[model samples]
Target: MTHRALLAATAIALAGTTAAFADAHTDSPFSITTIEYGERYLASTLIGESVHVADTEIMPGVALAAGTVDEWDDIGEIGDLIVGVDGTLQAVVLDIGGFLGIGERQVAIDWSALRPVYEEDNLEEYFLGLNVTQEQLEAAPELERTDADG
Candidate 1:
């Protein structure tokens, strides 16, 4: 009888220990945090990514400025990012126009103007969107960066 009682107490202690371990996991500092799929992107993948412009709005001014109401224009490609002194990304520079590097120039647009759209079927594939018109981009002043060789 003494041996049986000792064995039962041991079993109860073991069960309590298992329960405590499980609870600890739920309250641990190493508990899981989630960054949902498609929410984050690699900078390397964004460089040289094609940027597109489209007339997706129906406001009168927008329609007037947009010219076409339902067309997508491939405007430019991502060139570089402008970072603030405090380390925030403030703007994105794009390489607009040129056939084989003949007439291409860098133009900087505000960071807020960029919109990234990821495909539902493939997260690895995505494109950047800028809501402004193609003409506006073409007319933007060229962004000048000092050359390394200079």
Candidate 2:
């Protein structure tokens, strides 16, 4: 099947599962209320955390702040998110360069490359340990999502 068809099928499957969950009235541990609470708690703990890049060569978890070329000290923001066919996070599209979206480039880095920082079981930040600088991402290939059959 085509990628677009596959994506649509995945979406439909997820919607059906969500509808079933919504219709469920059981008092099981996996109830919708419990799931919603977990989601809300996670969001409250992780929303404004910073995402940095680490140098694994020096030490295992040594990281540095990541941002645009102009605002090197500022925290990098997630521009978009890419998911796999199984609804798993695959990559994160980040804005690396340019000012106010003028000459910025959207680059997708694999989800595995990022390391989540947690303090006392609450997410506080994230670090990307690809050992590459902002210049590398600026010069790296851009990611484009298209439905056209190749």
Candidate 3:
């Protein structure tokens, strides 16, 4: 019922499913061995898109809202058009910042604040299209962004 509880359930369910799917690994070069999930959010470097750890690593100074939880059932997908969907916590939003390799920052995100993207037909494109900017992300009420002087 609570946000934290929902996140816990989502994490447990995702971990269990991932464990079960682990044995199906193939010898292909693209085969993934392990997919580690974290609790922090990352700001996408590119606007209008979802950020992935595969593309970037977590940055410093960004903090994830730890322990927040949500239900997997409540976690809906943008549709059947995306590569990732069910079993993923709806709260795992990306936190991207900076310019072209300039002051970029990233994080895994709290898995309790995500809202399933409603359009899966173009999930990647849709996520990549998100207009979130570094200033907006840094100024996010949920985040505590400060300069070195702070």
> Which is the leading candidate under TM-score?
1
Give one digit per residue, the lDDT tens place, for model 3 in 1-150: 999999999999999989778855644777555632232223332223443221123232233233211111111112111113564543333434445535544443443333223232332222222223445446655323359413
Tens digit per residue, CA lDDT, model 1, 2-115: 999999999999999999999877876754477443355556776788887865632211113232312468777888877788978888888888977789898988866776
Candidate 2 clashes between residue pairs 3 or more apart in a chain or in different chains: none
Candidates ranked by TM-score, best first? 1, 2, 3
Ranking by lDDT: 1, 2, 3
RMSD of 1: 10.9
Candidate 2: residue 96 Cα off by (Å) = 1.3
TM-score on alpha carbons, each prediction: 0.59, 0.47, 0.24
In order, the Cα lDDT scores of the candidates are 0.69, 0.54, 0.36
Give the TM-score (vs. native) of candidate 1.
0.59
Any runs in candidate 1 off by more than 4 Å, and if so which?
1-38, 57-71, 119-124, 146-150
Clashing pairs in 1: none
Error of 2 at 101 (Å): 1.1
Q: What's the lDDT for residue 59 in model 3?
A: 31
